[model samples]
Target: MSEKVANTFDGRLIFLMLSILLNVFFNALTVSTNMGSAVWTASAVNLAHLFNLSLGNTLFLEGVIVAIVNLILLGQFDYFRLFRNLIFIVPYSYLLAWFKQLFFAMGIPFLPIGWRFVLDLVGLTGVAVAVSLYQRANVVLHPNDDLPFILRFRFLHGSPCWSQWDSNIPPIAIIVVTAILTHQLFAVNIGTILNFVMQGYIIGWADQHIFPQLHHHLDFKSTLH
Candidate 1:
């Protein structure tokens, strides 16, 4: 690549990698707060419980499955993308384990139920921003989000009778309903509801405002293609 092209490529790589790390970091923080509901976390929780496996292992397995599906659907599963997902997902799972252990070791002391609920909302804000940044980075998305994107790509992006709103419903319904069912297997909380309802607006706002400004600031004019 030309020097200028290489610079842009390096910058995009930095941005995408940083975004993924932040997503995992903030996700850990949200889970530590004992009030938040994330679909992936809930899914991990259920999976771990079902198989009596560690949450970290469950996350890794889920990531593996999701990565393959994403690659197949996007038809861009070159070695680089596969390797990229591999390195990112593997450490991400282990880091999750470490963070959760640290938090628990610090003593997840009792908070009032009300306080826990508030923390969930506070943590949700972090979760929203992290997810928004990662989505805008246009990198390999977490499986949890990628599935929804694939659904929209397949169903909503093409159908004439279905408007954006109509296309929007199914993916949201699929993930959220799956979360609810999984949580019911072992959890019930308003935090999950908050995650379900608030995400669309957050993502919309980020795409319109945060993403454009960020891309402009970074001068990100290229994709990884």
Candidate 2:
């Protein structure tokens, strides 16, 4: 292979490795938050179960309806991009299920209702850190990452300010909104607006701090030319 091509390949591999490591860390944090979310989902399911409703029926019907609505509103490209975020889903899902079952087996009590909010904040901070670092690396984005890009690019196509907000807003919004909605839907409250504020600042700070370091270390400009 040509020397230039070989170097390009090597650089990409390094970026991918970094991205994966960051993703793993992010997923680990998500499992923590998802534990609370799962409780919320379970509570919702249990409520349905109490009413003699089929679990499968709720999942199949609600899941499809939500998916269709999201697809129609978000567009095909954005909708399909959501699957890319699934990279961490399998492992996180397994870990969450196992943890939940283990807690149940041991007869552990649910987190004090107040503590669930703390867990949500902690999880959001972890996610922001992971995402900011990965994005600075400029590797291929995971499925979740694409959502912000698509939204920003589509709606704020002409605004420089929107461009800046585009990258940061989606991740923060997703984390905060998802946490809030999970609790609201299931009668479980986790965290407050402060969690979102702290996470967003941390992520923005990390992105600013890390990208410059990467540009210097990786000689990004030189590589591009």
Candidate 3:
């Protein structure tokens, strides 16, 4: 390949690697938090297993159901494009469950239910910070991030100021509604609202700090010219 083409390919690979590392690092931190929301995702997998659903199938179904609801509420489907990000989420979910199982296997005492809930709060905050930083990078966002952008662009019709905070609403709403419905259907609440609040602040902070730095680093203004 030509030098330019080679560089383009290299850039894509670097972005993908960066994405995976960021996800894995945050996920590890989240698991360490031993939070309710983090544990809840593991519980979902366990429940699916009890019913004979393979891990892959369960993740796919969950994504599909959530994506559908998001599309319905936002009255737009562009968020479907974000499914590409699921390429990472599926594997990451399984790894998280495996990590939980490993802890059990190692005879690590489980946290009390109350402590787990507190951990959930911490984990949610961690997620918010991680996602906000990732978004500010303006690199390829996770599937979850893409949903909010799609909704903002489609529903707000480009009118809303496209800061990070304004862009996060759609994804946060989707998670909240999904958690509610999932609770109703399965009799298990996942505490998505709290997750949104914690993560939302992280996003806001990232927009304020990380995005500007990335813009300056990229010389984005020069690219526009």
| Preferred candidate (lDDT higher): 1 or 2 | 1
TM-scores vs. true structure, each candidate: 0.71, 0.45, 0.54
Q: Write the per-residue lDDT of candidate 1 for residues 1-225, one digit (tens) a residue.
A: 343532354654665677666666656655666665565665565667667898789888878876787678766765655555666677778787677677557654265677666766766666666655655554555655555555554646622222223423433444455556555443225665676666656655665665344442211234544
TM value for model 2: 0.45
Question: What is candidate 2's lDDT per residue for 173-207, written digit by digit as tens?
Answer: 43446445544332233432343335446656665
Ranked by lDDT, top first: 1, 3, 2
What TM-score does candidate 1 get on C-alpha atoms?
0.71
Worst 10 residues of 2 by lDDT: 35-44
Residue pairs with clashing backbones, model 3: 35-119, 35-120, 128-199
lDDT string for model 3 (60-88, tens) is: 56555555554565566654334544555
Off by over 4 Å in 1: 1-7, 75-80, 158-188, 215-225
CA-lDDT, candidates in order: 0.58, 0.42, 0.47
Runs of candidate 2 exceeding 4 Å displacement: 1-120, 153-192, 195-198, 215-225
